[model samples]
Target: MNMEFTPDQLQRYHRQMILRELGAAGQQKISDAKVFIAGAGGLGSPAGYYLAAAGIGTLAIADNDLVELSNLQRQIAHNTERIGMLKSDSAQSTFKALNPEVNIISITQRIIAENVAELIRDFDIVVDCTDNFAVRYLLNDACVLMNKPLVSGAVAGFKGHLTTIIPGQGHCFRCIFEEMPPDAEEPSCRQAGVLGAFAGVIGAMQAMEVLKLVTGAGEPLKNTLLIYDGLKSEFRRVNAPRNKDCPVCGDDPYITIPGC
Candidate 1:
């Protein structure tokens, strides 16, 4: 891979390039990476921002929802002026303004079983920024089937959890949460009330994980779940070993195809 950098590129990524762990080579890797983010909401906002700012070559954001007044508190990528705009479009505008060098692709469609595979097929990494269990599970299954690395994060109330799934290497999201809970049992951010800044914390960490995976800078949170408690201001790591019987990424995997 070419490690050559134009003067402007070097100047833009000088601080990151200075790190012994991630020199010009790492920057080149990062610049060549294509990351697909599932949602353009709270988590996607910060994750997308940092990835674009870091000079990621291509960023694809998928979201069919429209921005609303209520989203501005946590969905930093969207503003009051962008109300009613497609979330993906709003995110594209924000990320482009932050770093015009980034190639941003906005997919204004809800990710579904029929299209999830095609949506993420070309990306090097997948970031789960979706809010609901259905979409989360869909993304997990798709990534596992495609043998792609996935960085998953979730936030509710004052707490947030994050994990990275590298297909055959470690546990996937399903290993930790075998199946999605019933709708009534699963509380939405609207019902539980999430702290805006708390979402930023987890989203930023997700972005960090992606950078690490791209540049090989530090350990990606393989098989480990990182939890943050905003009220206590503490972080904890839990072991998440792969489930040999996991339906999607197990010895006798049930989900052989992307949408199955």
Candidate 2:
């Protein structure tokens, strides 16, 4: 590998390069890695910014929504001035402003099962930042089928969940939830409400996990699920196991198509 950094990139990533766990080699890996973020909203906002700032080689962002004034509370990537723009486009602009060296591919369309695998095949890591269960499940299956590592997260009210899915190594989202809950009214960031800072905290954590994966700096959440209680400032983690009977990545595989 040609491990050369421009003076500007070195200055921008000086802090990361100085860290013992993430020195020049790890920094180089970060600068040569590719990641795909599946949403452009709250969770995706901070995650996208930090990943780009960290010099991830390429980022493929997909979102079919437009920025809304109401999204400002938690969607930090978009500002009032960009309200009429597509969410992915706005986020891409912010990412470019943060680090022009980061290659960004903005897909202003919703990802369906047919396109999910193709969209994910080229990326080394996948980040699940979507807000809905359908999209989440679809992403999980696609990543598993493609055999890529997935950094997943979800937040509602004052709590958030974080986990990484490594095919044949760790359990996937379906391993825990199995199936979507019946429409029994779950509080979402849009409905019940979420603290702006809470999103920042979780999103940053997700970004950290991605960088860790890219740089091989630390063990990822591979076989564990981390839950954050923002209101109480507590973090809890549970060990997860790959289910032998998991529908998508398991022995009897029922989710041949992406769950989306």
Top candidate (TM-score): 1
TM-score of each: 0.96, 0.95
lDDT of 2 by residue, 191-214 (tens): 668877898888999999999888
lDDT of each: 0.92, 0.88
**Backbone N/Cα/C clashes per model:** 0, 0
Error of model 2, residue 190, in angstroms: 2.2
C-alpha RMSD of each candidate structure in angstroms = 1.5, 1.9
Which candidate wins on lDDT?
A: 1
Show the lowest summed lDDT stretch of 10 residues, model 1.
Answer: 182-191
Residues 21-90 of candidate 1: C-alpha lDDT, one tens digit per residue: 9998999999899999999988999999999999999999999999999999999999999999999999
